[model samples]
Target: MRQPPSRTAVLKVTAYGLWGGAVCSAVVSLLVSLRFQSLAPGLDQKLFLVGGGMALLYAIGGCLAYPGLVFKPKEGQPG
Candidate 1:
């Protein structure tokens, strides 16, 4: 059986996961935005900023919320 990871280890893993997710999200967003730019004549700067800000907030919330799910304790182990 695998030993439970330390809190610090769990946090480190969470941080790395969050960073990887954010990078992936940003890259996808960039590609979509570029595609939009090609399809549309002009993009609204404020609209783009608001959308990006909302997405960043969502990502931060998910990073804060998901560690509990990822680091679940094994059966018979204290959480």
Candidate 2:
């Protein structure tokens, strides 16, 4: 059986995931806001929706276990 993650390790992973997601979200938000004045209202809404959706997805990935080592499987491996 695998040993459980230590508190410090869990915190580190959580921090990294949140920090990375925040930075990525900020960059995407900035780019979207910059182009907001140029994009048609419909396009602007679509962009915002997609960007927010991606950010949420990233956040979810953050809470998930590690790649290969955890429950996550390696790429190309059968589920």
Candidate 3:
């Protein structure tokens, strides 16, 4: 198994990314709700689903890339 990155680095990076993703998703959802509410009169439910889905995707990407954030220095392995 590949070794993990330093815990503190992972936490800090992930936290910042998550916070940004969350704020972006919230703003998008709010805009969607307001823009489409006129057509459906109550589209918040769908807007939330879309926003949540996007946030989930961002989180998954962050998690997948976390391992590579700090590559392990292989002993005796040539670059």
Candidate 4:
């Protein structure tokens, strides 16, 4: 039988996935905001802001889920 994945491994994958989503959202927002010059005066701004908020939320969730990715373990501590 195959062994189940460890908690840390699962968390690491989740964190990476969230971060990747954040990047994709930000990029798409930027492109949309820049490419659609005919959009209403403030609609583009709203879209950009909403996208930024989503990116921030994703990044925050990723950080919370896998803090080890952002902070190094102290010396002698098992990472």
Candidate 5:
């Protein structure tokens, strides 16, 4: 049987996934802003806002997850 992944591995994956999501969202937002020339400026602005908000949230999640991976107590050490 295969061994299950460790907690640190899970945390690392979570952190990287969140960061990757943030990067993807930012790239998509930039592409949309560049490709779509809407007649209404507000629409473009709203799209940017939504994308930026998502990216910001994802980045925050990554930041939170990273500490868990970095600050894990060593075996036999008091947390």
Candidate 6:
């Protein structure tokens, strides 16, 4: 039989996922900003959409990740 995941493992995975998301968001936002530099002159519309979508993804990821940090099983229970 397979063992349950540990709190430490869960936290580590969550942290990594968040870190990766932040990096990806930064890179993507930067690229989008650069791409629009000549045409839009500023973060007019598309950037907002990209930013908002990234924010939404982060929010959802955080919501899913936080449960692993907040809740843990007892010694006798499966994690």
Question: What RMSD does model 2 have?
Answer: 8.7
Candidate 4 lDDT over 1-79, as tens digits, reads 9777766666777888888888888988877877774678888888888888898888887886674767533444322
**Cα-based RMSD of candidate 5:** 3.7
**Local distance difference test, candidate 1:** 0.59
Worst 10 residues of 5 by lDDT: 70-79
In candidate 1, which residue pairs clash? none
Candidate 2's residue-wise lDDT over 12-33, tens digit each?
A: 5775786588569857965895
Estimate TM-scores for all models: 0.49, 0.48, 0.49, 0.77, 0.77, 0.52
The models' CA-based lDDT, in order, is 0.59, 0.64, 0.67, 0.76, 0.75, 0.64
After superposition, which runs of candidate 6 have C-alpha atoms over 4 Å from their true positions?
44-79
RMSD per model, one decimal? 6.2, 8.7, 8.1, 4.3, 3.7, 4.2
Q: Clash pairs of candidate 3?
A: none
Q: Candidate 5: list runs displaced more than 4 Å.
A: 69-79
Whichever of 1 and 6 has more TM-score, that candidate is 6
Q: Which tens-of-lDDT digit does each residue in 1-79 have in candidate 6?
A: 9878976567557756875786677567767777786775566356856865785677567555654454543454432
Which candidate has the highest lDDT of all?
4
lDDT tens readout by residue for model 3, 1-79: 9776666566557756875786688778778877787677457778877887887777665655454445443344332
Cα lDDT for residue 25, candidate 5: 96
Error of 5 at 55 (Å): 0.6
lDDT preference between candidates 1 and 2, better one = 2
TM-score of 4: 0.77
| Candidate 2 CA-lDDT value | 0.64
lDDT at 56, model 2: 68
Clash total of candidate 6? 0
Prediction 1 TM-score vs. true: 0.49
Q: For residue 27, what is the lDDT in candidate 3?
A: 79
